[model samples]
Target: MTQDPPRLSVTSQDVANHAGVSRSTVSSILNGKDARFPQETRDRVYAAATELGYRPSHAGRALAMGKSDIALLLMPNATFGPQLQEGIDSLAGVAATHGLTLMVRFADPDADETLRAILNLRPAVVVDLGVLDQAGRELVQAAGVRLVPQVINNESNEVDLLIGRMQVAEALSNGRRRLVYASLADWRLDPVGPIRLRGAEAEAASRGVDVTHIHVPLKAAGATEALAQVTAGSAERLAVCCYNDDVAIAILAAARQLRLAVPDEISVIGVDHTAIGQLVFPRLTSIAVDFAALMEALLRELDTNGYGPPARPDLRSSVRLVAGDTT
Candidate 1:
């Protein structure tokens, strides 16, 4: 090695030279503003940079720009947990590729407190996965900051209800009505439950079939009572569409208590398509929604500016008619 040509002091200028473009053009492309240039031209600059291993130090760029280049991710909970952690992981990967910092904040459900915490971060973009209520939306907007809401459940009117509603609709279509909806107390008013119920009602109305919809509070005693009604002899069919797999598993346990034969006498369905759904007896006929893809699209939307028209995802997951003994 002839000292590797003095290490070549690789810079944006070198990239411009290799790509036959101006230094300014290389700057724009490396700063994540390649939209200003044609795709071909952008590709050439990127390729030249890769060939040279030209890495622009993000910390140096932030210092020169008087900006932190950080992204703030906000969620509903008071702390980062598993679901929020997953979002952080995915978002962090995207941020690193773009040379940005990621800061996560959990909303305390108190508007003032949450708003203050978010504003302090001064993020280039804010992503909200936990904002659901009207007040929550208004609070974020009032912050005078760019915010992206990822309310998959009924937190906001914007996000899709693929998981909950689809599960309910599919369960009914499979002739598994006499449906019991079980939910933990916190999820009772969740938009998912009502939306799914609406879908079920619409389907039931169209078919002119009478289906019993029971709302059972999620608890051991309450599940016991609901199980009795579900397994009652008057009902020819029995199925439970739980708010989530946990509730469904609990109902399954309750069904066992009542000596009810699953799928033969009752079928159980659940939302979330969680691992518990698979581990349960007879497997479970569950609505499989792409939570990961949903999160990806959501972060992408948040990172971009000006609330461009919402784009629908090409990948759609349907609830599998998982033919377990329970239907």
Candidate 2:
């Protein structure tokens, strides 16, 4: 297949010509620091830029700003849920406000090449999702790059603790006796999944609740048989604390196949208020994470924490129960 010719990138001069202004005027308005231009002129320049789909080159901006114009986000390869994607969107917005652009690169933290690339770029800020040790921290600080580690993963277990506490409390409040955790078996979600499982198990153990660990596959078919067996012939009211909304959806299908009434016979609570969860039959009740708040926390950590020490930023995502027909 013939590839399309590279679309000519619209430049600042092009925008200036379209807006009937000097290139320097376009540049000044784009900088947002110069207030010499009138508000109307600025608006006109912005409108022209939007119409042209003009984006400033990061290297150009970095040269002008005397620093990398990028907030580099690691672990771009991971499957980002809607909430994390929203958080990243908020991060990008914040970065843009600071005259920095957001860039994503796929490389595991353990790889030496990733560190080398990070040091080479020396981005304005590095928001990390994977492991970073003391050496990595020192390298980043030595290179004058600010690093924030493990924002989404509950390395400190605070967010997990809250999610676990909420799941246990909500199920117990509704008089659920047997609590089964839909533990994820995917290798992609290792530490986070285990951390969440621990949180739920800890809460259940404290309340004299028995939480059966069911290692469920990522797909819909992997869960049906296991769920059928678990909910087969138990006298107690069961509530399955799902790993996430996808697992919860699998449980829903499994419940349907087994001919069980939703909330009446078997209740289900999911984490992550995914879009599909809202539209499903007996709409999914989920512990919706506060992505906006988490984004704030990430920014705060970047500013305040800096790179003095290599530690997981102590952050917790605020959560709320979005009630639905499921539980």
Candidate 3:
């Protein structure tokens, strides 16, 4: 049997002909340079392009504009939790409004190879979640591609710090003075754990509460062992601020095994406010990061750096305490 012929992609010239305008006019209007044109002409060009299902070719645009309309978000090698997923979704939504394509890539340990591949795409800017190494930064700079959240900014660490502060504040408000920071045992899985720990430490210091640091693995046995260290020789109530909900849940399980009463013997607060945290017994209290607000701030930063459009004016605090039985 004979297969159907492949359909050809619609082009700007086709849109121009359909709209009874020149190809240059179609290009200008579609590329957001239509201020000199009348509203009626701009409307005609947009309507024709939409009707014809025309999409600008990234390759062609790159040749004309020196870079493609792509915003690449470089994520560190870690578990993609609910909060991270929500931030990606929010970024994609905002990018669509600015006529930019959003792309995600897991950063490889070999920064050279990963960055080389990224440069091939000719992205307008490279945005990272604060995991880019010095080598990666040098390579991106050498290639002339913009890297967002410069070293001085430390915005990613600031967010982690906010999560840390929020977790400790919740525990403090519940009248738990003795504070413990439960960090993930694996550093590769949590590059930002140190920043969060610092935030917890800073908050605790301001309140005159000392925070002990402990590593808790995801497994039940490891978590139980860590909790034992916190409770040894001390009958005072403890508050544990976890790196994330998974870590918090693990501590909860350990507490159950040890027959410790939650929020009385020990209080737990987590970050991300994951769904599983709520499903467990004595539902977990967590710190919820408003990913939408974070995304808007990121977009605004990009716009200020001359890489994207202006972000919406509405912005609010990105972190809040979520009350639960655990805290």
lDDT of 3 at 313: 38
- The count of backbone overlaps in candidate 2 is 0
What's the lDDT for candidate 2? 0.73
lDDT, residue 26, candidate 2: 75
Model 1 stretches with alpha carbons more than 4 Å out: 1-68, 78-88, 130-144, 149-160, 173-176, 187-191, 209-219, 229-233, 302-304, 315-323
lDDT, candidate 2, 1-327, per-residue tens: 975553357777899899998876776678653476788898999999888878787665555555576888766344445788777767766555554567777776356778888877768888776545567767776777777643333355578677877887777777756888987656553545666788888899888878888977766567778886787667667888888888888888888877778888788888888989999999999989876666656666554545453434344537788888887
Off by over 4 Å in 2: 1-41, 44-57, 60-67, 133-135, 149-156, 302-317
Query: How does candidate 3 score on lDDT?
Result: 0.79
Report the error of model 2 at residue 321, Å.
0.9
Against the true structure, candidate 1 reaches a TM-score of 0.65
Kindly report which residue stretches of model 3 are placed more than 4 angstroms away from their true locations once superposed: 1-66, 154-156, 187-189, 305-316
lDDT of each: 0.60, 0.73, 0.79
User: How do all the candidates rank in terms of TM-score, highest first?
Assistant: 3, 2, 1
The TM-scores, one per candidate, come to: 0.65, 0.74, 0.79
Per-residue lDDT value at 72 in model 1: 70
Query: Which of candidates 1 and 3 is the stronger one according to TM-score?
Result: 3
Candidate 3, 77-113: lDDT as tens digits: 8754587777777776555445566788887778676
